[model samples]
Target chain A: MDLTFAPEEEAFRAECRAWLEANVPRGLPSGDTRDGFGVHLEWERALYGARYAVVSWPEEYGGRGASAMEWLIFEEEYYRVGGPQRVTQNGIFLLAPTVFEFGTQEQKDRILPRMAAAEDLWCQGWSEPNAGSDLAGIQSKAVRDDAGGGWRLSGQKTWTTRGAFCTHLFGLFRSDPEAERHRGLTYFLVPLDAPGMTVRGFGRLDGDEGFAEVFLDDVFVPDTDVLGEVHQGWGVAMATTSSERGLTLRSPGRFTATAARLIELRRERADPHDTRLRDAVIRAWTDAEAYRWQTFLTVTRMSAGEQLGAESSMTKVFWSDLDVRMHELALELLGADAEHDDSGWMKGYQFALSGPIYAGTNEIQRNVIAERVLGLPRK
Target chain B: MQFAFTDDQLAFRDAVRDLLARECPPSVVRDAWTNKHGRTDTLWTRLGEMGVLGAALELTDLDLVLVFEESGYFAVPEPIVEHVAVAVPLLPEPTRAATGAITAVTSLEGQGAVAYGNSADVVVAGSDAGVELLEAFEVTTLPNSVDGSRRLGQVSSSGTGSGVQIGDRDVFRRAFDRGALGTAAQLIGLTRRMLDMTVAYVSDRNQFGVPVGSFQAVKHHLADARIALEFARPLVYRAAWSMSEEDPDASVHVSMAKAAAGDAANLTAAKALQCHGAIGYSYEYDLHLFMKRAWALAAAWGDASWHRSRVGRAIL
Candidate 1:
């Protein structure tokens, strides 16, 4: 198998490298401060302006319509140049894919471009306080209006990432009260600014308002806002969660960049006799390289039109575990200063802790692997 | 970038798999454990005739990788990995039959052990003057390996005129790296087989009036094994790719692959054995055959700790 990219792909990489080098912001603000979030939004706008925001999307969706290989190269270059994390990830990665897959042409024409441009930041509304791992257990409800014009939603969605500043929320709501779990649910696109809707910001473990509690009280949603077929939200939601846990949420390039940083940090250490730390550093790098190659294989399959099945759960379990381990090793290598929250390693370690819990727990992913991939009998 | 084998490579692998299925099945593996010299000469000759022995020199990198992986999957008693991946690349033309070498100085010293020291016509041994090929007939053999089918033992040249020097320091180092890569690929293949066997046994074997595979405990073990192999498989190929291209960081990638694959294979073996209950530990069963082979190969070229330190040295 050939590892090197074709000449045209190489040229695409060069183009990405040049654009990222010229346009990437310097000394970008970090954390959940208003100013920092605003700067990230502006950066997303700048990316959209250059058509580098969603390189793998269709041209009509305000993307370059690049190949999977080009997208991988873009991701590699984006991380290599220390590109900022996408503030619009929920919209651009999770909901946008679902919209493209399940939304009507009218929805696509109206929604994707705005989402791509970051004009309407989106937050997920999947997990409620009681429905963390068992997402189908969510109690959120939406009822059709008596006049048959719209639906009124009433629910509280916790762990809503970027809910504090996001303009919209996409979620699964119970449309039929009599129907059982995962059967009567309907996916909806709701405006956070709708009447009776409120977002209560809360501090994460790292003292950032990256996630919040979104409360919807009799919020009216038009019929046109329904994402997919009525009572088919479970299937639509799977598409979103799969994309969240799969390639888009944790790309190999991100881990590669982090592993490179860890290596740099290790090299900066004066003492080289710490074999424990040394081995950990190498393990981090090895796992990252493995993930990169594995993603290349997955990309090859995708290019050949092969759908990723339970393998996405395996990827989620692997990358999330690796992320936690890598960050833990980084903190250990940072010595006593690792205790400080201001240190980037400590912050990273805090964030990595949430990876396995979100999207889906590793325990659930393992169950998925056991049942679907290995053909094990379900309990 | 493509990460899959070409059509020719797949066909070659299928051929190897078919041949191994017929000639090197579980019964043959079990027989070799009890058989004298533990050498399957007929199978080795057939492989040689198929050009599997000279594949490293004759085939592309991907083809050789596929062959090595298949050899590991079948746990072929012959030293095809040693002959093709390590010894063949460095030796001159007109290579003798079924070369088995020990470039690791530890395996050579103290007891002066070398794998297949008896069956190999020419045994390459590492010494202070680099690597040299010694005529097996001239050296005395002391048999007994932990893996019964391996036929490993100590070999003493005894002033057989210091043997014939075939490669120097750099060549020896590259040989060791290739050895590690081959071992890594074998570990991956063996581990994959272990995983499949465990899945089949668990699905069919019942306990407490239900199939044990239905239990979350059993499923989790297999799931972890699958995940480990999935991640490690790519590293093996990447390392092989690096070595084939003679990349500057080839050594580092080789160390990473070996370390990752060794750890993955060892873990898979443990879980597979645990899942198989007491039957897995029996000699009559085929499970122990792979277990022994994995144990032998895990520490063959370089163990996990050794490779980890090498990678650490490069990166840190």
Candidate 2:
């Protein structure tokens, strides 16, 4: 029933708030763009130097080994000061957790420090032209080259976010031809600079070079680059996708900060008499607060050793919808000017549009919630 | 921060839940619609005996909300929120000890209809001026509500000066917040019950030679309802904690909880009815019990729009 942070947690929060307030860069470009990605990487390096890059990881891995609660507090402080979106999230949030869980000691030592320092930027390679929602329908294959002491990968992975800019990728590939759908897959860490690989950057809906199609023509990945056991990538990939969908990727502090900004925006621009818009702002703000408390409840359960499984789908559906609605309301407040303005509202609105579509479509998440959380019959 | 109930608090909730399951089933709720006093006396006594009526005096706001939520789960035909959360807390020490006495509350200046006013042993009228405990008051029963079990009445002082001033405006405001928080908890319970019934119904009933729950459309509808409840539940609990800690922002937090819980309950009821089809439309089906309770409770202390306005004033 305790809701207030402990004294030490408060001290940690104060320390984070002071550091973020002092050092968070201003006027940084969108991290999704080519020019912006480079600047964002510099910011990531600055964060790493301050030991603020991976607060929840062990100290040996360039983190403070902070608790989950402290991690949430750090996120709160980070977003409260308008910290730039983490350019290293794919490596730090999504892939790093899986690597820590499943990676061998050699893999952890090699991958983690570089990841924290943003020395080797990483992007995901999950969705393809034919395998968006049906992720297990991956057509990518990794054939063993026993004599060469490696695997030869051949596949076309589309919608590989930031793949063109990233130095490395972590993805699933079929390693056993006879096995089908979720079996016989192996997780691989591939370098974009491999001899047979080419990454073609493309414009997303927001017109940023945030999307890339990675074409692999027998690109070789050494045996040491294998993430987990052979033919166990499906299990390994599920762990990463859950992190993608859950609190690790989208903490409540992000939305609450946006909600606070929305309130300030209303105070500055909106008509005092516009009750309709006022109510909408309140709804958005209240929902954001609700998400905050819900995250607290979740972290509390996790701290108590409860496993978060299919329920993360519920969190995904909630925040993705909330993000879109909050941004939509901001646009409406901007009215006609929204179409031409560069206030980042338009950019944010465009980015929020992708929340439901990526990290598994809301439709797919709903199916997961219905079938798994509610125990509803599946077709 | 730990955002869960303690074992003792949870045990209390389970005990209340079990008692309601045995004593305050749907049939008993149905009975209230036709019963003489619009309530069953025995269950009230049982609740009082269980110290539920005195929860505000003993338990923290966090523990007290669980009782209110369980009462909502059963759709109990009693003014537990009014009597326990609002009225009893303001009573004089000796009066507070009389747990079995039914005490309803209403705004003194607004003088709106009081829930369970006609049947209550006493009515606490409150406003910025002060709080007054009325021993006997004139009561004019209002029109029958959408929820038949929820009987409202207009209360006016009979001029015998039996009304004793007990507390001041600040105390009254806190009581109002508690009432709002308790109602929010109840709305959450009602929302859960409706979603559960709809889930069970869809899982067993077949249409097009397959279980209705097998349909993606039905699954999505139910999932949306579940998502609404899941997010709303924590807000309610956090509000309880805020109130328990007497945070300076407790009023706004309570407003957030009420608004979110109200919206969740309304949305769930609509989706539950739509999924239940014609059976839910009929009074004969049990789903309407929770749906109707949700409707009344959501709009009772303050509707979603009203609470959102309160929140907007604070933040915007």
Computed on C-alpha atoms, the DockQ of candidate 2 is 0.86
Model 2: per-residue lDDT, tens digit, B186-233? Answer: 999999889889989999999899999989899999999999999999
> What digit string (tens of lDDT, one per residue) describes model 2 on residues A56-155?
9999999999999999999999999999999899999999999999999999999999999999899998888899999989989999999889999999
User: lDDT per residue, candidate 1, B1-316, as tens digits?
Assistant: 8887778988998999899988998788888888887867478778877877777767655567877888889888877777777776656553544222222112222122467766666656664457776653343555566679887666666554666778787666777777778888889889988988999999899899888999988888989999999899988898888888888898888888988898998999999999999999887889989988998898878788888888877766
Error of 2 at B136 (Å): 1.3
What class would a CAPRI assessor give candidate 2's docking? Answer: high
TM-score of each: 0.93, 0.98
Question: Which is the leading candidate under TM-score?
Answer: 2
Candidate 2 iRMSD in angstroms: 0.7
Model 2 clashing residue pairs (backbone): none
- In model 2, how large is the Cα lDDT of residue A139? 88
- Which window of ten consecutive residues has the lowest lDDT sum in model 1 chain B? B103-112
Candidate 1: segments with Cα more than 4 A from true spot: A26-35, B89-113, B126-131, B136-143, B158-160
